[model samples]
Target: MSAAAVPAPLPLSYDDVVKNLEDLPSLPAVVMELLNSIDQEDVDISVLAKKVSNDQALTAKTLRLANSSLYGLQIKVTTIQQAITYLGFQTTRNLITAAAVTGCFAEGRCRGFDHRAFWRHSIATAACAKVLARQMRFNQDYAFTAGLLHDIGRLVLVASFPERYEQALAYRAEHDCFMLDAERAVLGIDHVEAGMALAEHWNFSDTMRLAIGGHHDPEKPGAGFLAAIIHVADAVVHALDLAQAPDGLVPPVSPVAWNALGLDEAVYLQLFRETELQYEEITMALLS
Candidate 1:
């Protein structure tokens, strides 16, 4: 049903939801261990690889990703250690995070949620963000993760309160508005707030927190470069119609985010093309 004649979504307070949001799509422990392992000194790649390989599903996905054109490895690596040896530790960690996050969600109960489309958009945005970061000599892994999970709060809401999220989706379709607007209108909290709460819940790093929490608000006092990068990546992805969102709503680009890129129009055209290429390879690898 279209949003036009839809009844208002049942009310739910953002605070109350956040307070009880502990059970939303828990990340596998391997991700947390890997993240925690990175912060310590003299960490052995073997140990880290073992942690990831322990989960057979995660290992297979991670291996497939390491071989994707997105990683562009020279030789076919058969195992996780070989992957770490060639791609380096940070890239390996990024691979695991991508696999784990993508694997966490069930088929959410929201009937029209378009789970496949949502991930396609997320992967496209992540690819776009990585291109931006590489050109800027910034952290590609952080940008990739942020863009990959930028809309995670929406996933959390869909998983936890499918009926309410369905209402927000209807509202978005009816009004032909941005998802954030429809979400706030119906759910009383948008994904940004929900994402920040989730990020904190998962003990995300500062860059991650900025990416998830400030992607839509890059002008926030401490939003930082990653936030702006994610913001621009998200806009570029949607503007290119990568999301295939029925409403076709592109979020307004923050001027601060847009101007920070300092790239020429020609560069953006290249980025758009490059993003689509990597997205096709990577999404196939991850989602297949």
Candidate 2:
């Protein structure tokens, strides 16, 4: 049978969808406290580094990242202070947030769900967001955080409702529909909506909430600039096959977003190339 001939998905209600959202592990309290401290203009880097060092895994990751070539460091960073000094306060804090949230999703076996591939896609999308933010002269720090956490709701859904999520994925394939559309058709809401809800629940900034919520639909004027960047970044990542997911789609860029960002075709192409190169270095830094 043709793909279009597949049956429509049965709808599930939001209430019926058991939100194990509360049970999902949150960012470590110390990490959250450090993030709050870093936001302060008078943040004490020495104190922050000492706190980070207490978490053995986070400390190692920070040291490895600090020593990575992504930062172009000439000397090895053997200590937390050195890592903090070398990476800078803002970048170090961002990395800590990224690291803390990386394991929010559970790794499970699904017919076509490639865990590594999903992470690669996510990282590439994040890289694209960061680069695009610089190109468009937006808030790079906020963009990076948004890019990294945009799809967090998908992880929540998969972990919280595996059978239903699997069915939604199957429905997407069977109907040749976009994953987001399929998610909404099968469940009461899509990942973007769920992600927004979760972000709000976590007390994320309005910028973050909008970016994650409107990433798939940048034309929505309510989301402002960050949403537009994430939308384009998501499309670029998919088009470049950075992650090579079996069901990934190369979505179209919103002309409205392009115009608002003041980007022409040439500028977009140039940014894409730069983002691809940066993805390699950033991925290595984070994954190392």
Candidate 3:
């Protein structure tokens, strides 16, 4: 008999993806507040600190990370309010965001997707992006959060359609191709499409939404530097092998994105060292 034809994935639009987005776990109210306030400098840090302190689990992780050598603090941070007092609002906000985002998803049931590896890679990207931003005089906070969430569309797709995502993973392995190709083939949609949808629904900033939508094509028109930063950060994280998944495939960096940073060899080395040092502490605090 002739080989059976593959069934076509049902037609999926942003609306379809948006409707399924409701099924994914919601971010805590405090996290939502923090994310929306990222661009506003005059936001009440004191109130936000109180809100973070109210969540026992989030508070524990934030303080643990703040007390870790990541900050090299002389004194221990016992509460979110104190952590903010010591680490400043941006750092405290980052810690809370990290804790909340990680806590939102437990282990997933996608057979081919490795959840632990995913978060590790994501954290590594965030660390790498922070290094890049610091070196290049950019906004480290946005860079870090954008890097951390660059692939969140993958999570949304898997969470909303586990079986189809598993098939995409299987297709990826069988063809030894990029996940995006497999996702398009198997699901009729890619994570960028799904992720951009979710970002919009959640009222994330336009820059962040563009980073999600254009990370794979950073050189494209309107991608801007944030997307470029995320793209390069992702490439660096994969090259570092922090995730250490046997099946990991490092995607190529856009030359435009790489050249835009204009970093010399010494700066690259510093970034590698700092990212490696920072990634472990963040992982243990948030992923543990």
Candidate 4:
């Protein structure tokens, strides 16, 4: 019949769903400490570097990214401190957080999941979010982090319960339903809900929790401007085929998102165009 008239999908109990998800890994302690330091009123750049250096893999990723063409620096960055200086505190923090989390999904074998492709999609979404935020004069840094981590729960679910997630995917294909709906039907929860729970457990900022929880539901209460930015960015990335798996749903630009950002068709087109051009460079830097 109609979209809304279709039977409402059954979802898992919050306690049951979240209990299995409670142990999802987070960014390393060093990375979390650095993030806390950077977001503080009085940021200590040296302190941030010290924390990053404690994780050798993170330090290497930070240096590799610093020297990548994304920055186009004249000089090489050999030390974590130098990398931090070159990338700036906020950009460095975002990169470190991304690098740490990416490691968790690097080796997993999720049925019907392509880990590399998933990462590419996430990087593209992050790039699009930053571009949109700058054009719309919102918080570019916050948008970038939100978009990068929005689908984090999917990684957790796939890694923890491959059979269940695969069945969810099958249900989506059979019913011509959205992924979230299928996830809810099979697992009694959707990635959005799972993601929000994880984000809360990690003690992310309210803005980040709201953005991740509502990325697919921009009109939901407390979504705010960040949610709208992420919602539009996620759609743009999927439309461009930036992810490993085909996004089953390519939602139209949310009218609420457009109205909230005051983005007319012309401006939206420009943002989309710019994002495509920058996608490769940003992806390489972040994923290197």
Q: Pick the candidate with the highest TM-score.
A: 1
Q: Write model 4 residue lDDT over 1-288, tens digit each, in one string.
A: 556576644555666556876556657887767655644777777876787788888788767766755456899988877776777777777777777777755455556766777788888898899888988788777888898899987886786667788888888889988788888789877788777777776778888888998888889877788989999899888888866466547867788986777777888788777777667776766566
Per model, how many backbone clashes are there? Answer: 0, 0, 0, 2
Local accuracy of candidate 1 as per-residue lDDT tens digits, 1-288: 656786755666667667767767677887887766656778877877887787899999989998998878889988889998999888888888998899888884898899989899999999999999998899898899899999998888888888888988998888888899988898888888888888888888877888798899999899899999999999999999876867577889998788888889999999999998998888988899
Candidate 1 lDDT at 138 equals: 95
By lDDT, the better pick of 2 and 3 is 3
Clashing pairs in 2: none
Off by over 4 Å in 1: 1-11
Clashing pairs in 1: none
**What are the runs in model 4 whose C-alpha is more than 4 Å off?**
1-11, 67-76
| lDDT against the true structure, each candidate | 0.86, 0.74, 0.86, 0.77
Cα-based RMSD of the predictions, in order? 3.6, 4.4, 2.2, 5.4
User: Which segments of candidate 2 are over 4 A away from where they belong?
Assistant: 1-19, 35-44, 109-111
Q: How many residue-pair clashes does candidate 2 contain?
A: 0
lDDT string, candidate 3, 180-258, tens digits: 8898888888999998988887778898899888889999999989998889888888888998965568898889999
Whose lDDT is higher: candidate 1's or candidate 2's? 1
